[model samples]
Target: MYNSNYYIPDLVEIQRQGFFNLLEKGIVEEISKRNPITCFEKQIEIFFYPEYYRLTKPFYSIQQAIFYKKSYVSKLYVPVQITDRKTKRVFLKWMLLAHFPLMTNRGHFLLNGSARVIINQLVRSPGIYFRENMHEIYSNKWSEKPSTSFRRFYADIICLKGTWLRIECDKDFSMWAKMKKGPKIPLLWFLLGMGLSEKYILNSVHKPMNLLESFTKEIEKNQRAKTFKELKYPYVSTSKKAWEQIQKLFKLKKTLRKSSSKNTFETKKSSIVSSSFTFFIQKRTEEKYNKNNETKSKKRIKNVQKGDPKQNSEKKIGSQLEAHELGRKWFSNKFMNPRTYDLGKQGRWSINKKLGLTIPIEQTTLTALDVLMATDSLMKIEDGFLEIDDIDHLKNKRVRTAGEALQEILSVGLIRLEKSIRLKLNGNTKQTFIQKNSFFNFHALISTRPMNGAFREFFGTHPLSQFMDQINPLAEITHKRRLSSLGPGGVSRDTATLAIRGIHPSHYGRICPIETPEGKNTGLVNSITTYAKISVQGFLESPFHKVYKGQVQKTLGVFFLAPDKEEHFQTATPDLRLTSLGFLPKNPIPVRIGKRFVRMRSHKLALMGVSPLQMISVATSFIPFLEHDDANRALMGSNMQRQAVPLIRPERPFIGTGLEARVVSDSGHAVLSKTSGYVIYSSGSKIYLYTF
Candidate 1:
């Protein structure tokens, strides 16, 4: 019977939070003491008594929370925020609760606990439940790759009312959740849950059918009471054999714990004394961290330049969260697939390889294309002007032995037709035309069927286009941007100018200088700021830059970037600081910008709104229609006609996708056909030999 009663669920939720707080506190102490890095060697907790992981809790009142089932536990998860203890403490308190942790093991304790060894083995096995996890949460703010931990952890977790919550290093949260007579929802809580499901269940890790009993047995077996029945340390009094057994047990622990257990306590008083001493040590460690933070803030006032505004701006640059994860292969497959990719990127790569250049979207391909486009269609073209069927002459042939090429190129695609009339004027006609308009431009001779499909989809008139549809991300870019000072400054003679330069427009002069006991601190100022935006058809890159865009019909990836350049407010947590991009000898190089910003593409004719997938369609449709400027052309063939192909970068780069491309000049330009409902490339570089 589900208890519509007291707070068992709340207690369970709160207990998890409390445990996280304690764990973080412990980690902070470890850092403060300059302890080596530590991590939890997790174990599948075994319930010794009630046959449930939840039953391991020593508190008798836990029964109050188990209304769902006294004997049944569908599943349990150990949602570890694989982050530093400090971050785990400050930002992720809510995460510890809401979901379930089969057990919360301390990283340091795992170094010696036998619990650590067994847990590692269990994780490798499929017997336990580990489901939809908030993977890869970074405690340090910046994370690169899909972290095994979770961030925005609060979004997925749900806590019942009346829960007792605890954070890392926190003793416990006894705050009354009794909602006072007030508005229906607290503004903060309401906002947090806004646009969210009315109710969200935990991303439950389903217990395996065969291993459910085994996992349950393990958790039930390992449940230890709050009081570990005092096993005499060393058990020396028993015999040499007893000592050997104790030594063996110690040996089984993680290296750190194995070394730590060298000393055995002889009495209860010693144990009590050790616990008390550990608490004080922990307290002292906390104080040290606080003092360090204070020192850092103070140092900023001292080290900043006496009076350099630009340098001041540099100092004003605060910390941010630029945690980009390692590239996902699926994301890369969007553009690259040498065997099955658009030759666009492959051509560029080939060029790069030939040039011995490491540029992402090889520049050589673009160069070759430019040259081809620049040349007149006099030589490469075989006829005076090419029609739809003429351009279809070339295509990928399934040549078992290079003899079946005709079957491939002659496939039914865009058809040829006459839409315009071209007249040849001789004496009488020339006289009439010359008298009427003095030009021979009125009569069109030929026409062609209209183009459609991915072409329309590319030109952006098609439905079910790859990007035009909405793709809600699992997590949003959290708005945590804060205005803070990171760089240290010293008192400058020209303090006024220095402070002005140091002020970032974000703060709106909220920061100012004060004549402190040590020196003069930079003061803030007030000034209205605006970004001069250009309505462009292009892609958005980082916070400050935009790439070229073709006519866009769809939105790509998580960030919605337009070909039109615009700068909105960058959103992030106020606590996080901005990090500059780091360059490495090899790429895809590790890079970072504002957390809210992503690099996108913009083309001359199209933009990012037209999905990258649609690009090929556009290029294919208008391949014959596009004319090469006289200046750049390298795609020229012996017939004096150019080919159609835009340059591209590798499918996946070190940082992001969408690299530069080159356009080759050809006789044909691709466009929509009025008669036909498909895209066709009309070649202009048709070859015609003049008989003089």
Candidate 2:
């Protein structure tokens, strides 16, 4: 019944596109964002703005690579332009970046003569996730572990590239900020260290006067303790110490300067005049214009005098402010620096979408505003004004495609390359040698080993990497489409909790619930549903028919929606009374809208029609009368079908699933005639045909 216009998405499209994207634009984008590499001196800036890139013919064919035990790779060359800041000249050169591995038509890579597939990694999406923590405490006298419990709320601002920020609230309603495994800092102290004023912090809090007065009492009481260890604010003895601690947390360079207060006015004035105030008159000569001009000049010189108590007090204040500014910069760099922290477009979008923020997506780092707003949201969550995220929900998780995986590997390689380039830039003394021979020596500076090693490490040792299943077409397709939650950024088997390993309602249509393995990988690994596809945001979505006034019309069109999106509408099963026009449900039908179950009139519902085989994967869907069999048996049947060997005398099943033709056609086993012909001679292994 399938027509040319009736589309069935290519099962292996994700893998194919992931590799092609890496070849076409992934490398360029990664390098472009990290463009204008700077050395420690900051005098020379090297730019890797790729004009364009192409995949040249592979050095060896796939067959040859497999036979010779060699990698099937294509040389990647990019035209890099280096702008000499000192010389004010730009030089363009074509450099061999890497010999990137090539993917075959079967959506696999030949890495060191072995066929491997990068399994899609399912990880928690980068965003602000609010969670409530419950701590159970027991008294020693009770002789048991669970005597009492306390509850607290926290929010995590997770990043794609940088350190994660965790905001926690204590029993006293005081907040704390912790950066990934670091000691926690009082939120008020953190805000102050980030350059926010007391007034601003007080205004942002609900009870300003109360919080300040309580904090003041605690500080006063703790000040009397013999040692700093007795103080509640262990890390921060003073506001200045808070700033210093913030600086230390980020490992920023020491920017606080010591000003010599003992220098005489003449010494200070002379140094200031020679080094800075060149515009001021050196001599009180007769060349002056008027008395007003001379008076103004004299006043300016007096302001520069060191012993002027006003100037001295001002310098102290200026120095403190300078240190504070440096503290703020160091703090901001932890979340805002592109080199240190990057939220990425997806992360930025998730944050904006969840928080209802209008942050530009291109600004792919958390701003102070983003943090402040997220903190406010966390406060609201504590008060039950907002909901905590379901960590296992598909909406909160995203797929890491092969392209993204490769991008991360390339990023690591680039970092290594940057370090080497910096070392060379620092060592070379002759400036002319840098411009002339440096370009030629650039070939040596660029190493394919790092990238190649990274690739090998990923494809060889990674948990998500697996040898392609060549048992059958279904097995191959399933292997490529497999999504795992056990890779680098995912949870480990030992630490994976029952809640995370259990099947979630969100997996209804997007993931095949019956196809998971029987043991440790039971729910950690899953397959995409027959009618499911990954969205642009890496969310898994399944196609559904839209219904208008309880009738599914062709004009209503097909809507592909993720689990989160489906929650907004009431969806009905496809087995509901179907007519020539569409499904027409009689009487009140059971539908799920949001988290509640409700019975509503068919005409009043914004009905969504599920596909017949939408809830199961392709291999599982091939079983006839699957609805009548036990799920365990069905799972076994599905798995075993893929391992079935093709028989020489093959015959179509008398009673089979409607997908039999499709399976046989797509299996790449049986040969078919291209044009109308008659078999002149037929044998067991040979057939001669007479064409039209």
| Clashing residue pair totals per candidate (backbone < 3 A) | 153, 0
Q: What digit string (tens of lDDT, one per residue) describes model 2 on residues 69-109?
A: 99988887777776667757676777777777777876788
Q: Pick the candidate with the highest TM-score.
A: 2
Q: Model-by-model lDDT, in order?
A: 0.21, 0.69
Clashes by residue pair, model 2: none
In candidate 2, position 370 carries an lDDT of 73
RMSD of each: 38.4, 12.1
Q: Name the regions of candidate 1 deviating beyond 4 angstroms.
A: 1-274, 277-523, 530-692
Cα lDDT over the full model 1: 0.21
Worst 10 residues of 1 by lDDT: 117-126
Task: List runs of model 2 lying over 4 Å from the truth.
Answer: 1-6, 85-89, 137-148, 205-235, 238-318, 430-439, 645-655, 660-692
